[model samples]
Target: MLSPKKIRHRKTFKGRMKGVANRGATLEFGDYGIKVLTCGWITSRQIEAARVAMTRHVKRGGKVWIRIFPDKPITKKAQETRMGKGKGSVEYWVAVVRPGRILFELGGADDELSMGALSRAVAKLPLPCRIVKREEL
Candidate 1:
């Protein structure tokens, strides 16, 4: 049996999650894939530019996933330590994506190339980003 405190804590967490879930609307979804335009902390102008670049490839018929990390206040010490200028502060993770590779794995009509496609798409993005890990799903 769960303690009273634990039950209360779980309810509170669920309530918070429910509130956040209600704020956003699902922009797009499909049987084959989905491209969601979510809220992020960076400037909308910057985010839109990246979206436009990715959209071009999607229009050509490929699965693409996009997510924008919300902006947060940065400390001066940390700001100076980063690789880029003050702008490259850790708080600014503009966008992250996991472009699908079903086509490549199946050897479809187009050349199925996951790494190449992901790299090319990421190259056009504004912020510094990389593919950290890969996992089977």
Candidate 2:
């Protein structure tokens, strides 16, 4: 699983999601990428699963770039626990995803191979996503 080696705080507030992602929306590092169509939380486990699927499909031939990181800590209360104790303990980390954010990118692969690898990764994700080609310059 991908996680930060060190974090400033153990627990943090849940931030607000308002607009489309201003940053990380463009494919900066690959020829083909996965663009999210909706906003949601992407757990580290989900990211890892998608990466595994993509790598396996490509047989490690192409280079992959993960554009997002799960730095936000999500706290959770125990099951059936009484309320009013305080904020729950940190349960897991999630990458807060906004619409139009690019999640994964692939380079060094042909169109057919790239699409096939990306499709495999898309199935592991929770949101609807599309494989996008890099803009010609």
Q: Write the per-residue lDDT of candidate 1 for residues 1-137, one digit (tens) a residue.
A: 11122222111110111112232123232222122223222333444454455455445555554433322232233633756553332222222222221111111113334344444454544434443223325
Local accuracy of candidate 2 as per-residue lDDT tens digits, 1-137: 98888999999988887789899999998899999999999999999999999898888689999999999999999999999899899888899999999999999988999999999999999999999999898
Per-model TM-score on C-alpha atoms: 0.31, 0.93
Best by lDDT: 2
Instruction: Name the 10 consecutive residues with the lowest summed lDDT in model 1.
Output: 9-18
Error of 1 at 87 (Å): 21
What TM value does model 1 have?
0.31
- lDDT score, residue 16, model 2? 83
